[model samples]
Target: MREPHRTDSATATRDTRPVPCRPADARRTVRHAVAERCRDRALTCAGQALDDALLVTSELTTNAILHGGGITGFDVAVDSGGVRVSVSDRSDDVPVATARPDEPDRCAAGGRGWPIVCRLARDVRVACLPCGGKCITAVVPLR
Candidate 1:
């Protein structure tokens, strides 16, 4: 398991420094980090929260790769409130949740990541970096 960089301070408990973007393995890396942090915090890893967290992580990372112009940073933090997963990319395009199709189309091959993230996460935020990028953060409650 590759360890992501860390920043320990008095106020913040567990915050990852920032993992470089690797689209192919971004989902796997973020999921692993989330699980490890949950375990470290003594949170149940086999519960629905964990499952939702992993699914949200995958959706966010996939969006970053496909629509955000490649991922530039990734971070996962676990605390009393909940688990927060942040994915940054070069593109400043904000993610919008698209409505589900009225009818099942066999040829439909894309769209749905944002809605899944919104549904799974308790809160979602998008912050524009001063440097010229944006970071999307999603928080999932342990309970």
Candidate 2:
């Protein structure tokens, strides 16, 4: 398992690194990174929040692979209240949340990723990078 590169500042501790764009590998890598960082920071990672964070990480990384062309970077930060997960991709298009269709036949083949991420994380944000890419961040509170 690869560990995240840690950087310490006055305000907070951040572990940021780049993860591969492959779906299966990216999901596993992100989960491992989150778990390891949480452990190192003495943060709780053995409850509903951990589960939710892992799920959100998986969904976000998968979305990057499927929709964002590829993942360019990833970061997990330990904040005062919670941990923030940021996944950057080469595509600048932000994600949109759409309600699930009542009829299965009317539903699109895909589009549930952002909703799932929003539901799992306490907060979510998207920032457009200077390189014309975008980074989607989700924060999961420790409980």
Candidate 3:
């Protein structure tokens, strides 16, 4: 099993304080937190659901870093319902799913992650923070 990276907090599930600078860090944080907190719950146990959650995590964090200026806050919480991953960045503009790669106008390298996130996450929300930027929360139900 992978050990959760500790920062100001003593454990992974409790260490929601770090603002991940990279997508991998955010994904790791989500993985550890969700795995630790939701292991006993049948619907929250690890499997394809966990993989979907990680993919959503990657997309959100990568988008934040690439388009939202930078990640200002990151957090994850696990419950009987599912794992909720929230990522806040400096862009007030909301995320939009663009055209597919095969589309004539869409950029080939990008525009795919957002749709993947939308598809995998059961509930997706984008809220503009009062301070600045926006926070995207995605809940991926484990099965």
Each prediction's whole-model lDDT (CA): 0.71, 0.72, 0.78
Q: Positional deviation of 16 in candidate 2, in angstroms?
A: 4.3
Clashing pairs in 1: none
The reply for model 3, stretches above 4 Å from the true place, is: 1-17, 39-44, 100-107
Best lDDT among the predictions, by candidate number? 3
Q: Write the per-residue lDDT of candidate 2 for residues 27-65, one digit (tens) a residue.
A: 556566556666666766667876777778888888888
Alpha carbon deviation, residue 58, candidate 1 (Å): 0.7
Q: Candidate 2, which segments miss by more than 4 Å at Cα?
A: 1-13, 16-18, 23-43, 100-102, 105-109
Which candidate should be chosen as best, given TM-score against the real structure? 3
Of 1 and 3, the candidate ahead on TM-score is: 3
Q: How many clashes (backbone N, Cα, C below 3 Å) per candidate? A: 0, 0, 0
Clashing pairs in 2: none
Residues 1-143, candidate 3: write the lDDT tens digits. Answer: 11232233322244355788999998888878876765444344677988888999999999999999999888887765567788889999898876565888655678888889999999988888877888888888866
- Candidate 2 lowest-lDDT run of ten: 1-10
